[model samples]
Target chain A: MTDYTPYVAAVYGLALLVYGGYTLRWHASYKKLERQLASQSQESP
Target chain B: MNILKKIQPLVGLASLIVLAVGLWYVYQAPADFQQGGAVRILYIHVPSAKMALASYIFLTVASVLYLWKRHEGADILAEAAASVGAAFTVVTLASGSIWGKPMWGTWWAWDARLTSMLVLLILYKGLMVLRHSLDDPVKGARATAILAIVGAVDLPIIHYSVVWWRTLHQPPSLAAGANADIHISGPLLPPLLILSAAFILMGLYMVTVKARQIEASRHLDALEAARLHHDD
Candidate 1:
């Protein structure tokens, strides 16, 4: 059988990129929304 | 009030810990006797593929709920799941292609499973695009829900494609039907299960956070519209 270490590595790395990317994106959106909520409350009050 | 939003931070933390442990388990497992190092990809690939299908199922159920009740909450969930599902499907397709190139001697083929999965991805994109195009939120949500339910027929087709058709992709190993080329055996099973749980936790956290974000944005939009109207 051919050595597939590199392919294996690449797949694992890609998994990190995809999952990590989404997690970061979700956190950013949550932070932005929280800030918006805070500002909106202040403006209304 | 979904309880998930309240514990999003905890969910995120648990996912990280689980992912780390899963990776550790994977490294500790013995290499496949048949596929050698390539079998390591199963730790990531199988979980992703499972999540891709699961997220869509969640989306379909959410869509059905929305259709039945005409609630914004259900629509938000459907929308979030579709977007997350789309991302997972992309991972599934990409990782599968990568795994296939070495194992199958080709990057891709017009296999039934692959083709149906591509269609699911396209439907997800359609859901996202439709979300933005329609100006009225309720109308957009209703229309999208209809589309989701209709498109859901593809789910079973994608799942059973290998059994129903001659496909290069392997059949389900976790359940009975066709034989898989590589079995999740001995030390390998723990890491596979651990990674699956980690992915599921992450998937749940994302959809919950995303649904909350979508609702918050919609509320913000309404407030802005009210302010503009007041100014007028």
Candidate 2:
């Protein structure tokens, strides 16, 4: 059988890149916002 | 919400672990008699497609709730799900195209199933743009919610496209009764199901994180507005 490993790898790799990239992006943004909120609350109170 | 925050990390970790297991199962499964190693693409393709559909459904429901109840959280949830759903749709289309190049001898076809899926991606993008395009947040939310509700008609069309017309796409392997034209064996089904579960967990984790971010940003906006009011 002809090797279709490259095609399979492309599919999996694309999925990882998209899902992993989004997760990291969201995590960083959320953490940054959370810190800002915490500091804002502390300053006000 | 606090409970969700506490469990979010656990859910993310579980999804990673489950995905690892699913990949292992896919590695163990033998190549197909006909398609050979190319068949392995189905593991990711099927699950991504399913998750894409599932996310859209979630978005539609959340959109409905937002429209009916006028809850900001539901609007946030709908927006979050739409973003996640868009990501899944991109993956689904990209992976399907990659899989198709070798199997179908072409990158894409203007078939019903494929066209509807593309429309889904377009709707997702449209929702995001509509929400941000307006200066008035309330107006934006209501307009996007209505658009989402209307776009949901595409879901059934996407689902039934295979059976309703002749197309390059095969009937759903997981479909039961007379609709099941493609029959995946018992051994092959497990990896697909496991990966699907993992995708669902991951998608849920992403949605929750996103919703929290949206909430926090809105809170900050309101606080800043109040501070300006105080100064004035």
Candidate 3:
């Protein structure tokens, strides 16, 4: 049997790394925006 | 609950299912193929290409909606789709090249599929640059929408590139009702299909989230501008 371990690992690894990074970035930005909005609202009141 | 608000979660759930299915398929692929171990790349390359195509199609639709409805949501969707599509397109090209080097004996070729894909990357990048150059959001949206509509002409060309020109790249192997020479049997097909579905769902979900972010950012900017005017 041809060993497909390396190819499989590469594919999954890259997908997880890239997509995971994106998810993290999205969460961070969302939190930052929420904080900013909260601060602005507080200032207004 | 608003229908539009639910789109993101629905897409997220669908994408998760797809990712699970893809994992199952990749583990079960047959070992008898000529490409042997490296055939696993198919799962990624095919799905990424499909996503790239789908992104451009989505952009085209959003462009039309922007022109007709003048809706900010549509413009934001187009921008988000274009950005994600460009990333997927790059992955497709890179993975395809890696697979081709071992199988086709070259890292690059003048094949129609390859050339057309490169053109798509360029067009997407150009549109993104155009969007960022303008200070006015409305003006940027209008200009980018027009560019997107014009650039959509390349979509059909990319789709038909293999048919129109004699190239090194093989014709599509997954056409409906034809499985004569294609080796998409057993666990491979399921995972590949599942991954494609997952990518599409994930792409849509990301686009929706990005669109909302853009809208919120614009609102914040407008509020800031108004406050500055009041202070003046």
Pick by DockQ: which candidate is best? 2
What's the lDDT for residue B47 in model 1? 89
lDDT of 3 by residue, B54-166 (tens): 89999999999999999777887898888788877887777766655555556675555666788889999999999989999789899999999888986676658654664
Candidate 3, residue B76: lDDT: 77
Which scores greater on TM-score, model 2 or model 3? 2
**What is the C-alpha lDDT profile of model 2 across B44-155, one tens digit per residue?**
8778888888998899899899989988888999989998999998998888787777766578855455567788899899999999999898999999999988888756
RMSD of each: 3.6, 3.9, 4.1
* Per-residue C-alpha lDDT of model 1 across residues A1-45, encoded as one tens digit per residue: 698988888887887787778767877887798799889979996
Q: List-wise, what DockQ does each model earn?
A: 0.71, 0.80, 0.45
Flag regions of model 3 displaced more than 4 Å.
Answer: A1-8, B1-4, B158-183
Residue-level error in angstroms, candidate 2, position B103? 0.6
Q: Give stretches of model 2 more than 4 Å off.
A: B157-181
Q: In CAPRI terms, where does candidate 2 land?
A: medium
Judge candidate 3 against the unseen true structure and give its global Cα lDDT, from 0 to 1.
0.73
Error of 2 at B173 (Å): 19
Cα lDDT tens digits for candidate 2, A1-44: 67899999998899889999898888889889989999998999
TM-score of 2: 0.89
